[model samples]
Target chain A: MKLSNLLSEKRPAILERWFDVVLETYPADTKNFLQKQNNQFANPVGHTIHQGMESILNGLLSGSDLQEFSTPLDNIIRIRAVQDIAASQAVAFILSLKKLIREELEKSQRMDSFIKELSLLEDKIDTLVLMSFDIYMQCREKIYDLKANETKRLTYRLLQRANLVCEVEEPGPQQND
Target chain B: MAKFSAKPKDLAKIRYTPPKTEWTETPVEFREHMFCHSAKPKDLETVGFPYGRAWSAKDDDWKLPDNWEQIILQGMKDLLGKYRSFQLFMDICVRCGACADKCHFFIGSGDPKNMPVLRAELLRSVYRGNFTLAGKILRKLAGARDLTVGVLKEWWYYFYQCTECRRCSVFCPYGIDTAEITMMGRELMNMIGLQLGWIGGPVAACYMKGNHLGLEPHTIKSSIEFFLDDIETLTGIKIEPSFNRKGAEILFVTPSGDLFANPGTYTAMGYLMLFHELGLDYTWSTYASEGGNFGFFTSNEMAKRLNSKIYAEAKRLGVKWILGGECGHMWRVLSQYMDTWNGPADFMEVPKSPITGTVFDNAKSMKMVHIAEFTADLIKHNKLKLDKSRNDHLNVTFHDSCNTSRGMGLLEEPRYIINNVCNHFHEMPENTIREKTFCCGSGTGLNASENMELRMRGGFPRANAVKYVHERYGVNLLANVCAIDRATLSASMDYWVPGVGVAGVHELVGNALIMKGEKERTQDMRLEPLPEKEGSENV
Candidate 1:
């Protein structure tokens, strides 16, 4: 069977197994809330991972363009960027999909015929991993920007107390008295 | 896989060792991605805050008025004269170190500056330099430090780090309220223009639009309507909640976060369902929509400004009394400060629970009753029918919010309602609850996403206690009264306890409420399948 045919047929099993694998990164106790509490707002971190995994799986199976993968890839990476995981560990879930797929195919005894197609899928996932690394870096950078910004804002009064700077009325269109 | 690479050596130790370094020499490290974003200049300016120029916390110079030093000293002098608590707190300190290990931040991060005594001493040191005669002569020998830029930076860092939960006061033999000192510190910071955006932005929004999310009149109506639609779908009951309707006997006020966010929205649905079933004569004002005052975290004047609208709206709507929802600081303001700042509420009568006809003597001054107290009264009278089995799936633990627990003595009311509504109720370690409760770590405007690292560290003690109950009893549900808790504890639970979920006390109330003519309920307010339904499906 072609890889696409195998993937389309085994999508549900692949996604479930992949979700469990991703959830395994969290502590054993946290997995139930991440799995059972399904509301997007109530369990946002859980929702993000679950939805991100599903979208990534669908994108992988369909072999969609890289542009189509941006939303899910960004969602998953952004969440992982803040979590207690190393940068390598953060994007490791992308690579875990390769193993999940291989195991699912092996369960159906189609691994020998699907080898070349699986390699093609692996290459697609490698591209996704790079994209994820970029997203993670961006999230990390944004966090730094916020920290610097907060430090300035929080310290503004202190600077004022020290007589470092003075407030000058800006002559803007909105500044009319 | 274990979440932490390095486990704490001892999670149960409750002792402290003061660091050898002098407090002044101890510099704060600004870790990346661990602080909340700065308030937008436009938002600050709108609220008339002295925010000028684009600035970053990493900047060398913060733009200020030319006479900033004089301004700070004058502000201190003003505060000292006005508040007797400030004067008393400034003058006396035995430093017995009873509160040394009480703070969640100190417990989690092991930072000496986080100690309640040291945290207050940061300000008291400045006071010794400027105010006291001994400090004028003895200076550093008397524990007095000159108000330098470095000291100011230390103040900003540590004060923001405090949730102002007043955990320290309970242990203080002198009964010095560190939260009072923190409020004064934040107010003094506002004197120079150092205000957090997470706090200032909501203050601005709440000032202009009557809610923190900045939802306008129509938006508030539509938001409530959206919850009504969800309630209708879940229970087959359509609740008609009146907004700004006059001639109602009572005015209902809740945290706008409830009208805007999840878990909170479900709690809001509980309010509507309970009210609709009782046919209670109540009105919600979109104009005075928000109950939680971020301004209280800013300054007393700003707090009073925001609080004025609540009573102003109540008077305008001609309601006999006000009914407050499950919020923390809002109650602190209502119970402690609101009457003093914006009251005489002479136009209103003492709040009487219409169901039980119990006059709320505790709230006689403000004429506002807490929803928990109101619900507890109903349950006491057996007015509303509750199906405790509906919530049997949850092993519930009630987290006593700091303000509600300390400020109002509202300890028994929430627990009474929770015990009546849920079958399995567990309490966290006694030291970590009731009047001795730990903060959610993200209260008092520290709930911003950028401060996740700081919040998690501060949340560790509370989460540690929750983990104790969770591991022992399989307690999955964490219930509380504060809207900020509803918003922030989810993240804390995700980080620390993992599978444990956070809910408002009322969200559980909504789940257990048996309506007049509802569907065979298969889902809770989150639309998650009910445990019984799941069991039936399996069968």
Candidate 2:
């Protein structure tokens, strides 16, 4: 219809403006629970996860406090799995492997350049997680599109059915004749 | 420097507290007695639209049969048209409920669907169902449904309920105009021959004649002459007003109601006297003289058709510019629709009030200037001798019409004139003032004699505010600048808000008028300080 509408379908909205909403709103209250309950994360894995979370947080909080006010849902644990996603699923798989690797290193109390090694792994994990999220979000949007189409199909079918039933169930003048 | 535009004030402070004063008042509930749109919708039987009122299709003139498929498609197509704001509204109206409380009708009547967005949903839901592929297949899930007789009735009821005051537009994030949608919906309803009797009658009257009040050429001329005589008696300035002056510098178009009726006739005289005093060239056209458009009443074609006369008259006159009178909806129609078909004319220049010699380029092409601005300009430039003390005894409150205030961004011009002309000036309140102003308990041409209940609702908030000032500050005069608002307030005075006398901003100017003779006399009890004109140039 309008020119801008056609372009909008091809281009994405300026969502980066609202990206920080995910960080500040994402439940800072859950930090102690995540750190204390899981200890394979203790020295090495914990440091890697924290580094990944920090990197994600840094990318998310910049624009408007008004945006945060409108959208209050900030906690995201399930989205951690969403973030580990990558174009090459191998990167995601490799990023997840660092959690266990760091835990193993910490159990052995390996201190030489331990923090430095873990930081690099955590950064890689963060990249993989972001890429995976991008991929997953695109997929989810497509899936909703499909769901919407299916909903339309059902509604049309229902309307047709209702129309037919009304025509048959109710009398017309010719039929009365 | 950028032209002066008041940035919207932060709306952090609106309270339910009433003004504490002992005086005549009506409870808010009694005044808010109006009903609209069927909420919590439900389809009775094999109705095509969900939640549609069950009705057998009939060929009767009143209750048209269900043409759900066609209507839904049409509504969808109209909404998805080339208009950018219309399209934006379709996509971005997240139904955030931010605009829920912004509707004057909603607040006054306590009707949820009267809320601007909810009223929109009546048509929008159908648009989604019929047009969008997803909605066609899954209408129920998306909350989209077909349009039926019941939905059609609700559309008429609620859409008409909206005066299109644009109170909702202020709160919309995308700056989408619901008035646009309301206009479209009204147009659609008329196409189906489903308009209210009162609105339909006026539209018919307007189409049959050149004016809404059905003033034949002779009648229109006589009304002007009679008003000129009234002007003579009131201000002692007398000269026969010439008509159909082809080469006149300006064609002063006013609503026929004013020319034919009381109080309004006097305001028309004020403009004439000001023009006469300033030695300005102006002519009034009997053909295009009527400014209030009934096309705004029922249909856009009708609105367009009524408005077309102005440009047509301007072409007929070959005049340099056109100036609108003190009518309400007339300016709204001009602001929104005049440029759409009859574009910027090559002949007429941008409006320059010859009285004050002020160039109103801001109100040039698509813009409009209320009479207050012209007079304010005159007084500011020392063009007219003003008798400010003539209004000394009257404690006046300015009633800003929804059209003049919210529609055209006019707030200061009237007060500017009144402050100079009157003694004591006051405002209504904070949030309920200016662009966020309340309706005059009746406007949108729905000020019908039969629809008492709805009229009562529309005027509730306005009456309450007037009652508030009348009680607390002892302000009895409601001095609004719009003619229709003045008329509506007069009708609602004893019925809605008691003990309030409504006058045009010009009438206040007239009251303090220092005529050509008879001054320095406190003969009348009003204690009018006579005319102050000594060296002011006479037209």
Candidate 3:
């Protein structure tokens, strides 16, 4: 049987394990709350991770040609970026997928024909890990960009008051179009 | 932590480590995205703010005028002479550390800078260095330090971290308010063009467009029309709310967050539904649309300028009194600052709730009544019919917004309204509620998405208390009156206490309100599936 078919067959168990592993990174105090929360709106971080991981897993296993794989990757990493964890720890969850898949493949007892296919899958996991890194760094950079933008805004008036800069005119307010 | 003989003997029993930093030489790091965005050259220019220019916070050079220090020192001298609070607060702090552990930021992050006493000391140190004899003579010995570019950066970093929640004031032996000190720091920062975007953008928007989010006249009408459509769908009642209609009995004002953001918009819907049911005479002005003043976060003069529109619109529309919607800092400004800045408002009469006929004597001075006070009175008079079982699905917890709890002492009215509307209501830990309430963490214009880490830290204690109730009693809905709370608590709850959603107090009121000629309700304000709609759902 193909590795894709095997992955499809064990999708729920694989996804559940991945979810548990990702959730384990949070502090013990908040980990239990995230685990027990079932409401989608109320626990959006968990829901996003749950939904995002499912999409990512389906996409990865189906071997469908897809653009914007990092979109779902973003959902998982953005929350982690703002979390207290370091950058490496934030992206470590992506690598866990590889371990889970390897375990599942070993349990199926098909080590010969699928060997090359398994290597190909492992390479894809490496690429995903790279993409996760880029996304995490971008999230961090975006945070700094916001801070810079806010500081500039906070002091704009002061600059004008001191005659240090020139004023630019704003477009007039529009009534209902 | 600084071990000092000056530390109060009674306050020494506290467990938290005092934040010890080298006041003279500590250089602030901007790596953390906790600061607000810089004001755009155009937004600042449009509002006639001084020094409107393109400057980068990331750049090493801030492009200050040659005499920036003199400018700041002059501003300080001017403020000290004008406001007695500024002068007294600057002079009186003994570093008792009473206000240290009380701050949510300190409690969550353990950053000594977040400690209320230390947060104030950021500016107080500067005051001592520049103005006091002890600071000039003793220098570091007096805890005073020269104001350098690095010290200016430190001021910008630490002041913005404070939500100006005033929780520390409740514990201070000297009655020192950190919020006042923070305001002074931010005001001084503004003179040097170090404003944060979360704050300055709204101030600019509110100044020019007459509302934050820069909603033009047409967008305001369209947004209300959308809510009207939702009101008709939910209650089978069409609400034709007047926009800027003259001679209305009262002019309705709320934060523009309610007009634009989720959860807050739901509360706006509740107001429309209740007003429609009672046939109350009121009109919403596109001009005075904003109730929450971002200027209050920046400085006193700008806050006063933003607040002027409220009474101006009231007088122009010939309304008798103003009915304010569910907002936290809006109440703080209205209750404490608005009258002093813009009053006697003798043009307006004391607000009498049209539905309940209960005169709001507490608000007689300002002629503005809080929506909770008005709604609680309606419930007391038994004016509107309610179905508490409609909200049976949500186990609710009340988050007292910092401004309302501490600024105005509006402790019971919201709870009174919530208890009447929802059967399951839980108070957070006693220490974290009422006047001792933790801020939503992102208040005072710190609710930007980029600062989620800072907000989560600030919001942690509030969320921790929420987690306690959530685990113990299964509370799923967190309700508060402030628009900033509605906007921010969503993120905090998602992080610390996931599965506990934030809502405006009125959203729940709308859920339980049974209209006189309504269809059988099947959804809450957000149009989610109502409990009875779930065929096999448990009660």
Candidate 4:
């Protein structure tokens, strides 16, 4: 059987295992809460991760283009980007899927027949890892930008109070020289 | 540069299981970006806080007073005796986990310790270990743990993680206010001079300078002058608001953040424009310049000390009653604690709206009225002309400031005004607003930049709700009454749901208010061109 058909067949199992791997990044107590409580507003981080993983899994199963994965990738990576984890660990969930897929394929005893397809699937995940890195960096950069802008916003009036900032004059039509 | 050497197999070897040890046995790791900086010794000394020595959360030696354990235990004992709510909360929790998923931090971070129940347990465990006889006998089986340095570290880490927004209390079957428990935890920490710089610095500044920004009297005046300049440029009307003037009809106090921060600065301009248009006889007091009391985050005594100025300033200025600006905790303090803390404002009369001639009998004792209530009355009486289309550019949604909604129940007034002013308005999910509002996640002085990650995590639920509205209704403006919401939610919206802006409700009101004798307006209070004039050169 083809790896794609096999993946489609094992989509639920793969997605569950992938989610467990992501949840493993949190503490045991947090992991349980994230897994059990499913309300979107009440458990947003968990809900976002679960939903994002499902979308990415659906995208992967259908062989969708990389661009189709941005929203899902962004939803999950944006969360991990601010979580208490290292950058490597933040994007590491994307790569862990490769090992899970390989194990599942090997368990099905189809590794030899689908080696080329497996290689292509792993390549797609590698591209996803890079995409996640970009999203992670974008979130982090936005945080830094927010921090700097907040300081500027907080001090904008203080600077004005000190006469350090002034409104720029709108340029008028120049008189003939 | 460090090379990316780990292979997929190696990375996959990362453990998926938590350690087998019990949660109580697990020590907290104070990771980078997880906590705020320690209070400076000078800031503590400024407010006469005990054990005013330099300390850092990262350092092994906290330089704590030698008898720190005794101080904390005794402080806990004293608090239990003094506040019935604290003691009742300590003893009453069944830990049904009703509040487990309610805290925004818990929802966002998924840290069990961030759960309101467990966060309270961090203290309740110590209460069991030290105070109860059955706990001493039963010990580990009774969920009791002594207040060791490790536990103290856990307490500091987890308690600071809570914004004390009280969403948990709404869900608790026994009405256990986790916020008061956190307040007690903070008070106990404060006894040993363990305080966050973001909070402690403001406490000292508010105590000394009458505002958290440490702006002197002249600087406060000069700040308002800048807002006046902006107001003039927007409306072609110069407003000359008085300060420290005797015999004014009312005294206005607002969070000093409005005087110094963006979005908040615009809110202050909104107040200036509104007051000017109403021709209100109000005087701003440099003595009681700030309505926000950062001291409330510290201890009951400090909160009273910081709050005493408003009534005192009102009396000194000989005003009839005090008018508070849009602030979260300020109203919480004013409506709940201020009357008991510093009342018999027998000297001041009950607040009556000058334009509408409406009596604020609810504020008879405190002699203070929220600006939302004041403005709602004005709108009810048709006292001010409004052009709702002036705010047509904004698809507005109101974020009920946690303190204002849960703390004082000042709910309908802001909405009534928003519905009157903005043409387009949407509500977030029913669960995320009103008395059950999620915090801006940076309230109670947790809005520091070093902990931006933590704030964003805590603010995720709020931003998530805003994102829902943004996607569904194209909500570009989040209108709120709290000054902290204005400042902190700005960063949160930028991080979580970019393109949605945070503004005070009155800022919307300022945009929509058609002030008498003003020139044809071309822009909103933030000086952005009005939607109709966006492409016109006349602007």
3 or 4, greater by TM-score: 4
Write down the C-alpha DockQ for each prediction. 0.02, 0.01, 0.03, 0.54
Tell me the TM-score of model 4. Answer: 0.96
Candidate 1, residues B490-530, lDDT tens digits: the string is 77786557799888888888888888899878898777788
User: Per-prediction TM-score, please?
Assistant: 0.74, 0.64, 0.75, 0.96
Candidate 2 CA-lDDT value = 0.58
Instruction: Kindly indicate the candidate among 1 and 4 with the higher DockQ.
Output: 4
Q: Between the candidate structures 2 and 4, which one is better when assessed by DockQ?
A: 4
TM-score of predicted model 2? 0.64
Candidates sorted on DockQ, descending: 4, 3, 1, 2
lDDT of 4 by residue, B1-539 (tens): 01245788887675544466777988887876678998888999998888877788888888878899999999999999998999899899998989998889988876778889999999999999999987899998898998899999998998899888999999999999999999999999999988999998998988888989888999899889988898999999999999999999999999999998998988889899999999999999888988998898889999999999888888888999989999998899889998899988999898899999999999989999999999999999888888888888889999999999999888899999999988789999989999899998898878899888889989999999999999999999999999999989989998899999999988988988888889988888889888783232100
The 10-residue segment of model 3 chain B with minimum total lDDT is: B14-23
Q: What would the per-residue lDDT of candidate 2 be over residues B1-539, giving only the tens digit for each residue?
A: 01113334622242212233321121112111132222111211111112223222222233444674475466558646856666667667887766776666664443456778878887777777776787888877776866665566667667878888887888888787888788777766655454544454455555666676666777667656655655555555575777888988878887766653444555666666666666668788878867888668655555777677788888888888877778777777787678875676655787887665689987677434567778888778876667767666567888777887887777898888888777777777666678877777567767554444465546656665665677778877788777677656665554434577776777667665565553343421122334453433222
lDDT (0 to 1) per candidate: 0.81, 0.58, 0.80, 0.89
User: Which CAPRI level is candidate 3?
Assistant: incorrect
Error of 1 at A21 (Å): 35
Q: How much of the true A–B contact set does each candidate keep? A: 0.01, 0.00, 0.03, 0.62
